[model samples]
Target: MGQANNKTVLLPLAFALGLAGLAFLPAVHGNPKTFAAFLGVSAALSAWDALLFVSTRRGGRTLSVDVALKKQHYLQACVQGSLMAYWGYYWPPVYAFAPFILAQLVFAYAFDMLLVWSRRDVYTLGFAPFPVVVSINLFLWFKPDWFYLQFLIVALGLAAKELIRWNRDGRRTHIFNPSSFPLAVVSVFLLAAGKSDITWGQSIATTQFYPPNMYLVLFLLGMPGQFLFGVTTMTMSAVVSTYVFGRLYFAATGIYFFYDSYIPISVFLGMHLLFNDPATSPRTELGRIIYGSLYGLSAVWLYQLLGSAGMPTFYDKLLQVPLLNLSAKWIDRVAGQWFTLGRSLTARQRNLAYMSIWAVIFAGMSATQGVGDSHPGQWLPFWRQACEDGRAYACPYLADLETSFCDRGSGWACNEAGLLHIALSRSGEDLRRADPAGAAVPLRRGCELGFATACQNLNTLTSGTGSFARAQPTIEDLPIILRGSKGEIRERDPSALYALACHEGWPDTCGRSPLTANSLP
Candidate 1:
């Protein structure tokens, strides 16, 4: 009995782990060395889980399919999210955040154990680890830097499962996809706060990382699971709609809706893995199509609207999924009513339905007022703070905004700007291509400031011998306009404009002059 139950959880987990490894392989440049920690941690956790399951089986325990499924999802979320954290950004802080991650998992496991213990026969976490894992993974993928926020999101998502339900005709159901709802809610909140970091896991998009072989490998691996979940239709529909609608929007407004290509690997993963959750999406064929179409449309619409409204694009799909998720009950009801016994919409009715959805999208997008960002004033303070704090991520955005000042003789500023570009050039084809010469402008300025390291780095970049960090900036890190140069260099700082590129902490600059350090810091 235990062996049977163990297969239930073990098979899916192994499959997911394999797929995740393949998917991240391209991004890691076929270098298994970088995945050392990721593999170690994942193996340890998975082994422990297997042992626990096997022990319970030895004690005459039998696992239900529901429990097995939950365990699979939970395992996937924890394992995949951790891998993404390590390989995605290769962010060192993941080690520091270990305690929090463990705490979150412990709490989730304890919560389920308590529920089962209290009501042995009646209580079962049917979706056991799915909701919890998804929430953790999403946070790890997007905002792992903000550990408190991750904990908050996990708590809120779990809490909502119990607290927020609609009771109708004595049949109660939660109105939101547990994992997606809190993400959507908090994403909006963070967007408003200028802290949302939605990049859609481009860190593992095989194509983006320069090697395409593993891309095919990952697609093939994930296809079986996607089909098994009956999500291929939804995933395909969302991808197609995103492309077509995105192109339409770009043509109409001269704005590139999605920075990456329409069908990047990340989109594939998200459409199948995140948005098309079997529990939240409609199960019916036609209903799934509508659900996916709505997702694509909502994603595109929100991308444009929120971007113009001064929020990040990270929340576009997050917001869209939950809103559509909330309508799952109604979608099923309508699908049932419409698809019953030889009932099919006529061509005209079908067109009308599509038109109505489009109309809503257009109206909603048009009606969204600008949030008083005529001068890009909203991000100015944020960028300035980030720059002052030596926040590396703020470098690219501020570099663009401060270019004119740099050109007009802010030597230190120009050097700093160059460093930002170098930082950004660490990842993404578009960004990498933008600085083919590799941060020559700012680095030269720093060199001119007598900063020896700046000279060395500038030499390294110019000679094309410099290497990038294991975790570097992606498309999300670039400012919208600076994504591609589109062939324009507005600034060539003249020698007349020279300032010391020195701050207290930059020891190389300190040797240049005490005044330089004082001035910049």
Candidate 2:
């Protein structure tokens, strides 16, 4: 490849890295080594394509080189999609996720082919559907039990691409990006159905690595695509608007709107890759600004509203894109109107209108502001029920409730909290702050309340001399500690044998025999 091709890829790639550096550099937290590892790997993966795109070009300015470049794009998509699926498969929650990913990809590819075979012309060797399916599936991997629901999402998203379109600028264009549309619609449904109460852990946290290596790779690989579309303006506008809006929101509400930092890596991907879908977004300059601003504002509003209502904030940022996509025609017309009007009016008047519109929107948002749930205690019952119904993911949340209750001086709750902490710690995450002697704080608290089991557990943890892991309790211990002393018996209960009954209504004679016994308590 020549200098021109290098510039095309390199410039946007540099711009993306620069923005990431600005966001992450100032407020450094977490392990730098982890972040560095992610950054380096992502850069390498991204550069692999860049090098290929550069090296595989035909000799000189020929028509076939353009065709070859197009093929490179498709190859890049395939390579990236394969790599992403492999990563998802190999990532934590391993086996359960990989099969679903393969299933979705196969379904998406076949669906796209059927559309093409019927003369609908939406097939691209799985390029379009592959990324959409894999990325969404990867994000939704946290809730593996909801396989049927995930399948529905993939089907609906593909169906939307074929079915939903509008006549725009003398050509029919899909109203929404396939994945974005389905994600937005499903997010709303999930919130309404109370499904959002379940934990849909962020993409990064779901990964085995600390710094979210998968997302970092995605952000890098996605940069060239964003550049190819020349929608960097939209990405910039959306990111900047979100940053400013978050600050203003925090100032007014005293609550952090997004993450601890405004522009986390996740936010960067949401802005650039998800929100800036060139096919669905507006083409004109003013339209891009309005579209991006609307997205940023709508995201913040939806996040606050849904999060206040006790729904997960995982999909809040991505939900508004499809909603906004529906208004592309109107937005294009408005941008055109602005362009014409700007030629007639003074620059000051244009600026005034911009400020005035934003002011009104912000003012309305402020007036309708809701006080989000300050106390997570209120959601304990619902979370508990969800946890009970085979949703093992709810353990972390139940632990949170017990922790909160224990903090309020409930001795039993303290014990429960200690047990949960130990359970979680045994499973790879140590919620307890004390290292080596995990769960000691809660156990000590319970012990002070005359809880014998808590004291014993605390002793086990601190001493670090138990064959049975101190972080977890035995089954027999649960019966003794949880059931109290009322059912105490020196002998083990034997399997009962029924004898002949004299009357229908009479209780039958039962026989019991104990074979073996061991010292327990």
Candidate 3:
């Protein structure tokens, strides 16, 4: 009976792991290296499970399926549905990946069911995995060739809720959040291994802005969760704190600190989705405020920290969640001890009050161009000027944005990027490998694309002639807005944006430096 129980427990996990691995063979069969990794993971899981079976002893354990309708999860499903409706409509990749998403749902439920059954006869299951899978997908996905990792990601999240448990009150609960735990773990491994290219980590961070009114969509879709879960305080504190910190950073530096919007759409999503898990977040109202505030401030700090390390900045939202989850109990305890958190109002009333304040602040952000569908910082031209103004961070970002435009067949963008590298050389900033010859690569591409000035500049450099004059960027020479997925998108929002810039009439206010300190910190 004892040995049989061990088999029951380990066998299902091994089975689930094997099936999940095999499911990816078709997706990865074209590449030998990727296929080898997939097979290796499968073999490792099998061998580990067999070893556990041989070495471990266990008495027969009773199991039962515990069924409870968690309103928080199902309601989150409704919210995710609304988010998917709009996001999927805008980026059809949402639809393209629908089958895999559906497969994972099956895998999560099956894996959770089997894993639970291994220890006990009763397994409580519902839509618990829905939000976990969807949230992780929104934040990160392995590119198509490496899509097999997606299965492991989903499985890890599901298993976290089952395996990593701690005592709370009279019962047990998972210490880390299901979705965040896996994402944070994977983020660290990727960062340490310096292997972020295999995943769409960067693209997901940027392309989240592809949908229209994404900020507004996030706000509206988040309302039900806020109202029902009484997490409004957490959301309010997070948003306000991030906004406050961003304003202060702006005060110190001429740059808009986030380098995009006052609050980037992806980070905004993190504020709402990543850290606001009701179960994982703090319990007391004051604790929730502390939790949210810390998340907001930490996100800002991590953005700077990650950038300086030359790693992906998308990890800013992810890295702090598990830490917060672990500290939640202590935060509540500290709040109860040190602060006067006596409540005169009911939890519902308190949540509504917080939501009302958030509404006003959000409106203010929208009106003042703090965040919206469009912003001055989103313009490539603004960053180009900043790059030329000798901002080290701006050069790499400018090169990236300009490369996107160049990929869309914009010869002028190619020329602009080449010139920016030349400018970088002059300023003694060597962010991009510090190579002066890097200028010729883009310049040659622009010349081939039939841009007369690019051809002239390339000829001037390669023909042993003296350096050519760097062309000054003007309205005519620049691509006004980055549009499509590849920066080929054309849209009319630029009209209103520029009209506002021209109206502000600040010195050089062609939407470049509209507000903030005139000097860097």
Instruction: Specify the highest-lDDT model's number.
Output: 3
Top candidate on TM-score is 3
Candidate 1, residues 1-521: lDDT per residue as tens digits? 12334344344345325423532544332445424433443454356546645665676554443334454465446445544453334334444444444444544543343333222322344445544654445433443323335545665676666567785436776666767777778766766776544433323232222222323333344354453444555665676577677567545643334533343434444565677777667856577778888887787787679766756555566777777877776777787666542238754444344445533543343243111101122223345555566544344456664454455444445555666675556643224326646568766775675545557777777777875222211112222212121122232231111111121122232344433323322
lDDT of each: 0.49, 0.52, 0.72
Candidate 1, position 321, lDDT:
76
Model 1 Cα displacement at 456 (Å)? 20
Preferred candidate (lDDT higher): 2 or 3 = 3
TM accuracy, model 3 = 0.82
Candidate that beats the other on TM-score, 1 or 2, i.e. the better one: 2
What TM-score does each of the candidates earn?
0.49, 0.51, 0.82
lDDT tens digits by residue: candidate 3, 374-430: 677776657757766766477877777777666656677778778777776766666
Give candidate 2's root-mean-square deviation (CA, Å).
20.5
lDDT of 1 at 330: 76
Ranking by lDDT: 3, 2, 1
Candidate with more favorable, higher lDDT: 1 or 3: 3
Predicted structure 2, TM vs. truth: 0.51
